[model samples]
Target: MSFIRPEVRAMFLRWREALVGAAILLLGLYWSFGVTPGLLSWVGYLALIIGAILLFAGVQRGRARMGGGGPGVVQIVERRIGYFGPLNGGLVDLEAVTSISLDPTEHPRHWIITHEGGPALHVPINAEGADVLFDAFSSLPGLSPGRVASTLKHEGTAPIVLWRRPDLEKRIARLH
Candidate 1:
C-alpha cells in the first residue's frame, strides 16, 4: 500500500550528507596524523580534504536526483518527529507533526511535512486518490488544521505542504 520503498538509496538527504561529512572528516584526520606535524596546518588540511569530498558527493547525488534516478517509493507513511516507523507502512503520531500542507501542482497534488530541523519533505502522492489520502491525514486525532495549508498562491503555482515537525524533544522527554 506504500509507494516509497525502504532502501539505502532512500535514506534522507540530510542523513546522507552528514554521513559523508563525517566520513571525510575521519579520513582527513587519519591522514593528517600520519603526514602533518603542525596541528593548525593539519586541521586546515583535514578540513579542506573533507570539504572537497563532501562537495563531490553532493554534486553527484544532486545530478542523480535531477535525472529521475532517485529512490522510488515502496510504502511511504509519514511519521511524527520522535518516532521512525517502518517506511511506507507505518503510522505517524499526530502530536509530532507540527504542520501539514498540500503541495500545489499543475494538477492536483498532496504532500506531508515533518519538522526535522531541515527542509520539509514534499512527498508526492498519487493524484487519483489524493483526496482520500488528504482526508486520512487530516482526520488523524490531534492533527491541527492550521498546520495544513495550501502552498498555492494567486499566481497558480507552488509546492504543497504535507506535514511539519512538532517539537521532537518534548516527545522524547515524555517517552523517557
Candidate 2:
C-alpha cells in the first residue's frame, strides 16, 4: 500500500545522499542569510562549509552508482575487494592495486582493477554492491571522486585508465 511509484522510489533511493546534502545546503543558506545574527549566524557558516562538501561528495557518489542487477556480487572487507561473478571471480587487495580502468566497450561496462603480480579483476559497473566501490576507489591515494565519476561517465570504446599508483608511474618513467 505504498503511495510512491516504483520508478520514483528507485530514483529517490539512488540519489538519497545528494538529496540529503541538498536539504542541508538549503538549511545552511537560509540560516546564513536569514535574520538571527550572533552565534547562530556563525554556526550557519560552518554548516555552509560542511553542507557544500557533503553535497559535492554526494553528487560524485550518485554519479558513480550505475544501477545494480548485473551478474555478480562485490564485497569489500579488510581493504580487499572480492568479486564473484557467474563465470569468473577474483580478489584484489586495495594496497596492491596498481591501476583502475574502465572498459565501456563491454555490454554492461566493467571496472578493471589491476594489482601488482596478479591478473586484473573485472567487475561489472552494475554488479550487486558495486556502488560501494565508490568509497573503496576514493580511498586510493591521489584518486579524486570527481575523476572516478567522470571516468564512469566516459563514452569511449577503449578502456580508460582511471588511476595509476604514483610510485608505479615513476618506476615506469624510469624504465622508459
Candidate 3:
C-alpha cells in the first residue's frame, strides 16, 4: 500500500528543501528594507543557499538521466515455484515480468511488478537512492515480482529474504 517507493524519497526531500528555501527567500526580499533589515537579509541569504543546494541535487539527478543508462526490460510470466530442497524457496523463472521503468518520482530502488493474477511485488535492491529500487531489481536477471512472490509469501512487507541458488551464483561469478 506504499505509494512512494524508497528511491524517490531523496527526490522528495530535495524538492521540499527547495520549496522551503524559496519561501524564505521571498519573505526576506519582502522585508529587506523594512524592520530588522540585516536579519532579514541574512535569512534571505540562508534561504537562497538551501534552495541552491536542493536545486543542484535535482540537477545532478537530471544529469544521470541524460547519461542514458536506462532501466532494464521486464517480462512477466505466471509460473509459481514450489519446494525444491535447498532452493525450494529461491528459484525464480525468467518468463514472469510485467513492465519496468526508472521514474524516480514513483517507485525508487525497487522494481514494482504486478502479476497477471497475483499480488503486486516490490523487489528491493541496491540503487542510487531508495526511490530507484525498481532500477536495481530490473537490472538483474531472473528476479520478477511473481518470482519473488513464489518464494516469499508476504506482500508489501520488508526484510524479504531471498536464497538464490549457489550454482547460479557460481556461474554468475565465473562470467564476471
Q: How many residue pairs clash in each candidate?
A: 28, 0, 22
Q: Which candidate number maximizes TM-score?
A: 2
Q: TM-score each candidate.
A: 0.28, 0.93, 0.26
Higher-lDDT candidate of 2 and 3: 2
lDDT of 2 at 163: 92
Q: Whose TM-score is higher: candidate 1's or candidate 3's?
A: 1
RMSD of each: 16.6, 1.4, 15.7
Better structure of 1 and 3 per lDDT: 1
lDDT of 2 by residue, 1-176 (tens): 99999989988888888888888888888888894788877878888888888888888888988888999999999999999999999998899999999999998999999998878999999999999999999999999988999888789869999899999999999998
Residue 22 lDDT (model 3): 57
Candidate 2, residue 147: how far the Cα is off, in Å: 0.8
- For model 2 the local lDDT of residue 86 reads 100
- Tens-place lDDT per residue, model 1, 72-171, is 2323245332212223322344444556665555332435555434554444443222323333454655543333322222224655443434464468
Report residue 113 deviation for candidate 3 (angstroms).
18
